[model samples]
Target: MSDFVTPVLLMQTLAAVREAGRIITEAWEKPRSIKYKGPIDLVTETDVAVETFLGKRLREILPEANVLGEEGSPAARPEGTTWIIDPVDGTTNFAHSIPQCGISLALWRNDTVEMGIVYLPAEDELFHAVRGEGAFLNGKEISVTDESDVEHALVATGFPYSIREDIDIVMQNLRAVLMTTQGVRRFGSAATDLAYTACGRFDAYYEIRLKPWDLAAGWLLVEEAGGKVTLYDGVTPFDFGKGILASNGKVHKAVAALITDTDD
Candidate 1:
């Protein structure tokens, strides 16, 4: 892909995402009114409001780009250049007044993610990266760790919402990692976990059955930060709603081997 994206466009897109953060922050100040989209799945008014705000502002920034968001706007898979977004990545955490959730946005040019921005409103943290241009946190550059040993590396992971169907695989992988790594953490937000991995805060992150919006932006961040992201098998390209394995490249192969099921 050519370096067609302009600085003005990135500036405008960041402004829109920050606006979404502002909306989320405003909603956080009030008593949360939570609604259930499934038995354990959640959707909050803040999610809808932020998505709506983002949709409007982003379209203004790129009129030619289509929008695909988690909150039900433009439900179909995007065609051509599009924007993939998750208004609130950790609805359950936010509902409990936990501050681990954030907004995720990425620019998709056909199959490749061209730009990504993940904003945590609670902490005022903004992570963004453009294709081929390295990753950044609040304008400062960032990179993944060089740690090569899984025994000393800190790892992060998440459970699929349909735990009943995937619990066996989840626990098996968790057990393997917990047995070998420095420790493991489940922070409830895939975006944040991936972003943290990009900045060397976490050496790696893995999860299954995640939607595109969950990791779209963060995936770009990790790759641009000198890390690698792939499917669990370690060779396939990770896609929407699939299992993902990301690491600092040093421990990737070793970690993938540990997590993979030989029977499967």
Candidate 2:
């Protein structure tokens, strides 16, 4: 564990996140004031409100750590301790009164994640992990699936917001994965996908063109749960740029081969 992470700090962080979760739940009950960032991309007032609250509270909790949120934040930050947050990971689902959305928060420093928490307030499921420790949902420990066969694995994925230009590639990879895996699911939330993978709910999860806030926390959760995370090539490290594929380690290479068509 990093010198920055302590039991008290972790508890403080979780309390702040749970408070943020209350904000999401409150906003979710009423109609959302939605705005489109792009043709299909969404940003709700709830998203902004939660991010704002998190920014304020987290700053108070860790005075040294800067906040990098999905909303109103720089695309990247310099080397330092930072809080990477997705106020609402599944805004579309939340807008539709679905229960799959959640708040994703991670303590990131010097290219490593010290801790991560993905809390679905609507469903009341909170998944968290600390480096060198293990993953947990609510309070129970969690781990990735042990399945090693691609044909029997249940996979999860999401398309990029810029899907219009990458439809060909998205569909191509989707088709290959669908044929290879026993089943495929798109929950419309990258954070949820990774959290589910960490808890063994999904054997693997992959996507392209994701921001740091979306993958930062879940990245550590997957690894802590004894899984593997990488780009489509299966060897390259993910710098929060694109092509993220996370699996149970047992079936990582096989799924990567399917997505990249390297098996052919």
Candidate 3:
């Protein structure tokens, strides 16, 4: 792996995600055609259109890297760099014109994420992070909140599309969190929630069974913003396939214990 992320590389990656934002923005302006990927999952013409644009743009930006996009893209290049892209994070919301969706992108290399960018086109908010440079919002530096009291913390969360099969589990966790934290929010977009947590809009965020594209960018943003991210156990490392617990470091352990407490 390279020792550092170059400025050119960062700029190009940011441009690709932003271009993706522009694509979604333009698509949102016109009539929208929506489709269902499953009973609860949604797909839109804009999702495919933006994915195609991102697939091409990202490869052009980093020819050496492979792409894994949510909308029918190829598998990742395991040995080299990989760009993970979620063309539209909240397709249902986008289809409903709810303006809660965004594009999520992340770059992975040598078993670690090097950069992440989440763009909410409707809101014109761009949240980005370089591994060591800290997180930013539309070029302005941002940080996680310092709230340590779980009862006073505002946390965000989402129900995964897999909720159909895991409704009970989702509900159990939701109930636990609702009682433990000051409040809970369901924003329909895990990527957006994580960005909000990174920027101190929310003190913590957690969710289960999310895809790589959904968690990759957001996880990096939280970490770079001086937050802690881990599995529900708070000791296990966070990966896309498992449940996640992210907080502003101060409340991380308390939240994790609550979420992972079996007797609750």
Per-residue CA lDDT of model 3 for 54-156, tens digit only, reads: 8888878888888888887655322358888899998888987778799999888877788899999999999999898999999999999989889999989
| Tens-digit per-residue lDDT, 126-160, candidate 2 | 99999988889998999999998899999999988
Q: TM-score of each candidate?
A: 0.96, 0.96, 0.94
Report the backbone clash tally of model 2: 0
For model 1, give the 10-residue run with minimal summed lDDT. 255-264
Clashing pairs in 3: none
Off by over 4 Å in 2: 261-264
Task: Give all candidates' CA lDDT scores.
Answer: 0.89, 0.89, 0.85
Could you tell me the TM-score of candidate 3?
Answer: 0.94
Shift of residue 228 alpha carbon in model 3, Å: 0.6
Give model 1 RMSD, 1 decimal. Answer: 1.6
| Candidate 3 lDDT (Cα, 0 to 1) | 0.85
TM-score of candidate 2 against the unseen true structure: 0.96
Backbone clash numbers for all candidates listed: 0, 0, 0
Ten residues in a row with the worst lDDT in model 2?
255-264
